[model samples]
Target chain A: MSNRYEARFSAVGGQGVLLAGDILGLAAQKFEGRYSLQSPTYTAQVRGGPTKIDVIIDDEPVMYPKTTAINFFLSLAQGSYDAFLYDLRDDAIVVIDPVLVTKWDEKYKTYQVPVIEITKTKVGKMIMSSVLSLGIMIELTQVVSKEAIEKALLQKAPKGTEELNLKALRTGYEEAQKLLAQET
Target chain B: MSSASSEKSDIVFWQGNEVVARAAIAAGCRFYGGYPITPSSEIAAVMAELLPEVGGTFIQMEDEIAAMGTVIGASLVGKKSLTATSGPGFSLKLEHLGYACIAEVPCVIVNVMRGGPSTGLPTAPAQADVMQAKWGTHGDHPTIALAPAFHREIYLDTIKAFNISEKYRVPVIILIDEVLGHMSEGMIIPDPSEYEIIDRVKPSVPPEEYNPYDTQYGDVPPMANYFEGYRFHVTGLNHGANGFPTTVPDICHNDEVRMIQKVMKDVDTLTEYDEYMLEDAEVAVFAFGSTARGAKMAVEKARQEGLKVGLFRAITLWPFPEKVIHELGQRVKAFVVPEMNLGQMILEVERSVHKEMPIVGVNKVGGVPVPPYEILEKIKEVLQHA
Candidate 1:
């Protein structure tokens, strides 16, 4: 693991992407015993506008809270992908939701997953898509442990839907592991 | 049981605004009066829910003026009061802020600044309020304002603001920008007993003998509560030692001079700053608020490139640290100031150094923070010119 890791989660408003970043930061700080900083940006509109959160995890203190260069970029929509494409480093990993993000560049290594479909089918809610994408990112990058993420999810997830969200997270993580194994 | 004692004492993650609300509670703040505004509404919301549970009072006033007025009233009755607002709301509270200064009420006013002249960007960051925090009240009264760069510093600074307000009988301003207000980071909420908490000094004389603005012992006069049988007047007028309105030339002149001397004379104890990599440095970046975070990173990167760069961050914004800047000016080659506003604080740096060294400003005003690379470029430019 590197000393510093920067990740950007981009999605439209009301997708719970900001909450996903909050939980990831909490997991890294509270459970993983690391330092994390999360800065979120969104428009004045409550929904249907582009939103993004920059999360920096490090062993040392995070001096600059904003992400300078992206190490991992997760795009849940084509608009967000296009808006944040210029922020990626030369060798950054890009993750896209296949249903929402249709266009991508061929030069960068990209991973496509049907995160929204999985959340809708397994968790019976569209808002859980961010939690599903969070699981996939954790499995692929291993930035934080699964146990830590699950602990934060239990603390932050909505009441009475803990079981369904847990199931969605497990399904997303298992599928990502299978994809990486096949690639290897 | 207090949350500090009941909850886990280890490190926890919290947003900057939430930390401010929690720190107020920890510092024995019993009354919160505020109006909702963008980028700062979370502080009011958290206080609304937390205050009642802790046996304190929370009020949402009709407007920002009334909000500040309510807190000032509560403070006169011997309660530690606080109010949080953003740019426009801060503007509306300036009238009452001047009242608090002249009446010698101890309270805390938090401004989580967004872009402004008038609501320029409700959700973006700007440090344009640097001048307003000092001169916004429209008077020659003393002001002590603090600016914190990160989440952990926000918690400690909030407590310090309350303490300074109580100790000196002045309204202290905690001026934070939108980026620090909305960001989340890991911070350790210390045990309640670990920090020093100061309360207002009460009157030692009898009710009939007590004078509210008496300055015989020192510049700061001991306070008396409203309903504590100490019948005294509180107003924005130029009053004498008896707390009533006065027009005598010597009485009014002395009153004004005492207010200024109370804060200006104790500049050494009132000012606080963070100095980074200043040992044998040639160039120093002077920044404050959220911009200081980027300045620290720029200094670190410059050090790696064999550049003698350091950072001078002003945690205490007002009663500007002139002595420190004057001493460093004789040693350092140049000063680079980066801020979210367009050269608001660089003016102070220039005034302090007396043009003895080259001072450069890298400013941004469109609601975005000045990035670290921009400051690095300015540092290189200043080095070449020097």
Candidate 2:
């Protein structure tokens, strides 16, 4: 019931998780210090290992960003969700791509965004999955304007592929709307 | 009134580890020797980057022992040196740290503590290293240690650690935790000129007239650097003013006793802590480093919920903050110590405070933090019982 929310992102190390956290941090800082915390847990395994980034953005000063419940949990890979689903808030929303997450409860608020499908269609690369997920997250959060986020992304992301990522995000946004419509 | 180099910047956001390294850089520390460990690796990494940029050197020693040994050696060459590590690494450095103490070598050690006893928790911060920082070495010796709660103090307090080490010619410990080490926030980085950096007093007299261990002239003799063509033996064994081995019970006892007094005499100026809400509260929770950060949040939340809860954080871990602990122990009905390990600092609190009163320990091991809610719960438990 609390308007305060956190987005817990899980993936393997090669999935650009630390980059994702930095991007989220940039977005928050650009949005006037929304009391956001971007804490990432990296294990000893150097590459292709489990990575969890806890991004908690609250309405007030954040003391520590750890909690047993997460309002938004996204698992880019099925293994990520399995490792973290036990701690998800009961009513929390989950968005996983059918291609990435082979099995997911379709009856729940889980929406198979087909993130990989959108990424491949829009950007011709599955690496844009995180970009597309960002689009879905912006559309859902409504905490900041999507345009502001896009601008922030443009300002922050590296040379080249910025526009493509934006388009990929829009694709994820539209696909998420269609999937949610079907679920309702 | 000045040397050659200078820089100016009023304020900037900085990481605790970054500031610790920056402080060392500002303190004329041209040498940084350390092994990499969680929550503390950033300091080593930063020093690796910053040191060479300014004509200094950084080495990733094989272990903490070598790290401490090299820093001491580097200090004798008239270079300010430092090392940073956590619990396991801190333990490893203790033997040589005692070496630095007995030899009266001035160097700074930054301990970014995590949960411990072993490789307890790498990421989570804990304040359980308080007692360890004080008594980690084997024998009776004066130790100068400071704990900084915020990123800003990590920089300023590091300067303090360097000053104490240089002034007293002993190892100074800058005790922080994993939380502070990694936590980044906005801070004011003072201009280099605004702070006074102290260097060890070097011998003005000729090399032939020097006495390395002389206790006559205010206990610290002038140390001429190797570059200046003055070389003297530095030993771990008790030596005369001439720096030679001495086993006479009187000479050894006097040397060791005088070394401890050099820092203990000024312990008043070294002890730094912040106490909040304790004057009126019957329950005060004692914590430090990351746990103190948690305790602050918990105390504020409890106050909003109409509970009179106080917080006491030890900024100076060594020589113990007994004054604050003793004073609060009498006024407060109970003392709650929340930390990462199982009652490392609580034992010290118990020893300092009146044992007749309630002294509860909030401990969590296995590399996790003692959560704010758990501390709040202990506060409630104490209040109800009181």
Candidate 3:
């Protein structure tokens, strides 16, 4: 593992991007025993506007909370993808939900997935797309342990919908594993 | 009061504002009066939910002024009270802030600062309120304001703000910027027994003999709460020892001097600062609030490149630690002051060092913190010129 790993989750407001960042930070800090800092930025609009959160994890304390160079980037919408694409490192790993982000630069390695569709079909709710994307993020980067992410999801997920969210997470993880195997 | 577990400490992930609410509750703060404002509204939200659970009172006042009024009134009745707001709301509370100062009410006012001269950038960060927190209320009265750099200090300094307010019988301000107010990190909530909670000194004498502002008891007279069987007057006017308004020159002068001395006399004990790698450094970075986070990283990176760079972080911004700055100024060849504003605290740094040493201001005003490289570049520029 690198000494430091930085990730940015970009989506429109009300897409649960902020909660995904929160769960990722809690997973690293609480269960994985790593130091992490999460800083979020959003507009005044409550929904349908661009929002982004930066999460920096490291073995040592994170001195600079904001991400200067991104190692992992997750884009849930085309607008957020275009807005934040310049911040990614040259060799950065980028994940896009193909339904929303149809166009992208070919310089960086990118994984295209139908995140919202999988959540709707497998989890029975479109709002759980952020959780599904989180599962894909863990499978692609292994930034945090799956068990740690699962524990954080259990702790943070709403009381009545834990089972459905867990199913969404598993479906996304399995789909990503299959895609990676085919590429190799 | 909720007790901390005696067996072992529990570590939890908390945002900076949440820590303030939790620490306030743990410090026995039972009354919270606040109006909603961004970057600080969460403190009021959490307090509203948590205070009622603990049998404490949480009030959503009509405006920031009313919030300040409610906090002062609650404190006068012997309840530990606080209010939280951002830049614009803090601007509105200055009238009552002065009232709390002259009336000598013990309360806490938290300012989670955002960019502005007005309702500027509600979502962005700035440290421009450094001077306003000191002289925002219009008078020459002494002020105690603390700035915390991270979440842990947010928790600890909030409790300290309450303690100092109770100890000196004055309003204590916890000055935090937008970044620290909204960021999330992990911290261990220490055992409650480990905290030092200070309550206001209650009157010991009979009702007729009690003088609320008596200097004979060494500047801080024991206070008597309303309806507590002691009838003592309170007002914003220059009051005598008996607590009633007094226009007599001698009485007013003494009252003003005593209020200032009560805090200025204890400057040594009240001041708090952290010095990093200053023992053999040629240049030092002076910063406070969220700016120090980037400054520390700059200092570490500069040291790795064989430049003798260190950091002097001020946790207690008011009662500005002039003594420490004065002593360090004598040894360091140059000082770099970095802040989110164009240059607020740099003026204080320049004044303290007496211009004997080179002072450079690395400032940013676009509602973002000064990057570490910018500070490092300034550090190197100063060293190269020296």
Top model by DockQ, which number?
1
Query: What is residue A159's positional error in candidate 1, in angstroms?
Result: 4.7
Candidate ranking (TM-score, best to worst): 3, 1, 2
Tell me the DockQ of each model, to 2 decimals: 0.47, 0.17, 0.44
* Total residue pair clashes for candidate 3: 0
Q: Model 1, range B248-291, lDDT digits (tens) per residue?
A: 99998888888888999999999999999998889999999899
After TM-score superposition, the amount by which residue B347's alpha carbon in candidate 3 deviates from its true location, in angstroms, is: 0.9
* Clashing residue pairs, backbone N/CA/C < 3 A, model 3: none
- Docking quality band of candidate 3, CAPRI definitions: acceptable
Task: Point out where model 3 deviates above 4 Å.
Answer: B1-9
Separate clash counts for every candidate: 0, 0, 0
True contacts kept of 2: 0.05
Worst 10 residues of 1 chain B by lDDT: B1-10
Each model's lDDT comes to: 0.88, 0.76, 0.88
